[model samples]
Target: MTASPPAHDPEPPARRRGRPPRTESAGTRDRILAAAREEFSARGYEKTSVRGIAKAAGVDSALVHHYFGTKEQVFEAAIEVAFAPALNAPEAVAEGSPDAVGERLTRFVLGIWENPTTRTPLLAIVRSAVNNDTAAAVFRRLVAAQLLRRIAAQLELPDAELRAELAAAQLVGCAMLRYVIKVEPLASADLEQIIARVAPVVQGHLTAP
Candidate 1:
């Protein structure tokens, strides 16, 4: 038998294994997420692609699909990264009186975008939503599923759901105009001034008759 092919030379060290060493799957997932965020932010949701994200992330397109399954899933992940900190706003709002809830909510929401750490992602989401319907749908789902419903649950009003949704729309709209679209005067105005003018309106939507 030809000496059994020289006894296979003990299969050698490199060829002994059937597959490469397993890596930390979570690391790859996180890297994909980071890359997705950058791609989405830079190209917007409509223009971003799995291949582009994978190339930017230094991975295979199959890897992005393996981690997120679909472009929508990737968008959802990016939104989560963008909105994670703001997720705590409902809890903060729950701690205060109904009368003060509007101001508190305003401050909390606006404060997030005012900070550079949070502002970048928030602006990215805003810009993408404005330019792409797919991004807008994702944003709506996020606000409805996380922010609006949670805050509505804390309210004792009859029209809590509608009111909460309206408030969310107002907040998001203001952010779009002031920050994303950069509408003059509103965009250049001080944070405190905008809060003072808009908080009462939001509060009214929530607590008014």
Candidate 2:
């Protein structure tokens, strides 16, 4: 009798359960940012938590911390993505006709608020900044350094840095009224009308003798 093939050893018992090693997936960072945007948008910055972001992202809380380090970092990342086109203002100012630079800058910056896609998160970030000193610092740094300073650097003027910041202040203030605060007449004002009124001020700041 062909002895039955030696019985295979019983399958090794399954390894006991334990936490799995953390793996950073390629899209994980992007996923986290998207989730963060939603959380901050829905709850505001102070109310948003890393655990909430992780829950929305379908990842462990530790994974969110691993990728972003802290909630403030996550907020900064979200704002950067939302403001990317505006943050690119330096290039627009750099390439445009000198006379039209202010108009182009005004349009580009306001156009972001005009677009619903970019506006919502911006509202969240601005609202958070208003309430939280830490958030305000992050917002101020990015706008000053990435957007304003770069424009200032390209100018041929005394105190170009201050000039650029003043122009930015006008645009940012307009955004606050027109978009965030939803001031009645300004909120409903015609885009061209608003642009017409604001661009001159910006031009003066940038090109005044």
Highest-scoring model, TM-score: 2
Model 2 C-alpha lDDT per residue in residues 131-179, reported as the tens digit of each score = 8898899888988888888899899789999999889889999999888
Per-residue lDDT over 1-209 for candidate 1, one digit per residue giving the tens place of the 0 to 100 score? 01111222433222235552346455666777888888887888888998898788776676666558789889889899889988998897899687988988888998887787788777778778888888899888887889888999998789899998888778888887887788999989999999998899889988899
lDDT of each candidate versus the true structure: 0.79, 0.81
Q: Report the poorest 10 consecutive residues by lDDT, candidate 1.
A: 1-10
Each prediction's RMSD over C-alphas, in Å, is 8.3, 10.1
Per-model TM values vs. the true structure = 0.81, 0.84
Task: Name model 2 segments beyond 4 Å from true.
Answer: 1-24
Pick the lDDT winner: 2
Q: How much is 67 displaced in model 2, in angstroms?
A: 1.3
The TM-score measured for candidate 1 stands at: 0.81
